[model samples]
Target: MRVWAKSGVAFNGVIAVVVGLGCALFALMAGLAWPAIVATSVALAGIAWLMTIRQDIRRHFVVKHPFPDEWHEILNRSVSFYRKLDEPAKRRFERDVQIFLGEQRIYGVEGQEVPIETKLLVAASAATLSHGRPDWEWGRTRDIVVYPKAFNDEYDVADGAKIAGMVQEHGPILFSDRDLKYGYQRSADGYNVGLHELAHVVDLEDGRADGIPGDLNWMAAMPWTDRIHKDLTNKHGRHLKRLLGNYAYTNEAEFFAVSVEAFFERPKKLEQRDPELYRLLSHYFNVDPRTGRVIEPVD
Candidate 1:
């Protein structure tokens, strides 16, 4: 129940040190700066102390799932993957969702409702990515900011340049509320923005996002790299496009994310079209997910 990820704690430590030194340097350049330097050092010391106690505070609040029946009903309706699970697995998923909700915050944009449904949907995306790795945590993520429509880094409402979702190394993950709901509501389009972005978070776990996620060993990494290289740089060019769709060809990270969406949503289709890549993802995720056995109740 650590509040900060290992990397995040280290990053914060580095920031504190850098800020202290920079303040000291600026004070030294001025004549009467001892008081300023003392104040800066004290502030940074407070920051360091807060960082040290963050984990303790987080541990104090961690608890088992306490969601009511209404929440489970929402899951049964919107989250097909959860609906397919047996009672035990469903409980496990619910536990994971509760854990995630406790650990991270989800903020809505422009007075949008951050209801239990929204929180559960976000949790389902996280649970699906880390179901194989129970120890996996989103400690690096501080919050998930959801905009009503699409937005850019500057929060501009771009038309054609609209972004569906994005995961950042040093900032909150961003999502469009409209697109996020669509991703789950549509279910099987192989276009889940939430899952796609969460997959990037998985890739970032090993401190990098260069096509290889943290789940793979060097042995698996090597072959995955080779396959990606062959596909991305192939002379036939459009063959990879045909196999994985156009967005995947944008880059290696996108390829992995797009493949993850397809892996979960259209596993059989992916296996039929590109069995090798499908097997790679299947091994990485540790589930076939080819049955497509979700029970989406007709409204």
Candidate 2:
């Protein structure tokens, strides 16, 4: 079986191999041999590569197991996006959700249990973002860490003012259970800590959170980046504040995330307010949220 652990949760596979190699130093110090050390290093490298490609491996078999009835019940209750998908798309969404759950581990912190409903909602958020891209898989993040509430980096307390959900570069994502629930519960207003955080995760796949997503080609990224820069400067205008929000002005990263929340949650309003921005994002995400139609790019 294959399993993934958040960075902090599972390093044993790597550690155990490394420790074994380190102990081999004692043998090497006595002139035992370097060939065995080389062999062990190669084995460890293979294990690491396997871990990196585990998602693709999981995808190969994940489609074989259909989503469970329990997952269906939870999705019907907790995920609005799942219910709105077309019949065939609904089936595809379910398969993607199953694959997502299989690939990522969601851990509850401070004795707070992560309910099945919470897991379904998290998967739904991911499925919604990638609904248009058939081959899209959540590759940037491996594990999800859920806390009972928002928290500061060093502090143990839940401070909603500080953080809600965060996706770190080369690190596991963090989410406040309360905020995450609230994010899905409310459908609009462009404030979903979960989607916002995951958007950051996607943006960071290319090693930067500069609002340029790796999924976009240069032809698309050029114009999209131009508009993004223009919007970033114009975020404070009276008109955009109603749509993009003041927090979006914080940076290009926030603009992308906040706009994603708007794209999914308040698509109708966003489409109404700024058709140009809406179309750009729609073409980029490959979905028109209002009607659920996949718009093809003009080549």
Please report the candidate that would top TM-score against the real structure.
2
lDDT of 2 at 171: 86
Candidate 1 minimal-lDDT segment of 10 residues = 290-299
Which residue pairs does candidate 2 place in steric collision?
none
Cα lDDT over the full model 1: 0.73
Number of clashing pairs, model 2?
A: 0
Model 1 residue runs over 4 Å out of place are 1-65, 110-113, 234-240, 291-299
lDDT of 1 by residue, 1-299 (tens): 12334365666677777767776777677754688788877687567756765764464455333668998888889876776677766766676676788768788876577766767788889877666555466774557888777887688667764788888876778888778888899877788888998888878767678777866778879978887777677543564467568878888888889989988887777777777787787767655465422232211
122-239 in candidate 2: lDDT tens per residue? 8888888878766555773467888777788763654444788788778888887788888877776677877888888878877788876767777867876887888887843557
TM-score of model 1 (CA atoms): 0.73
lDDT: worst 10-residue window of model 2: 1-10
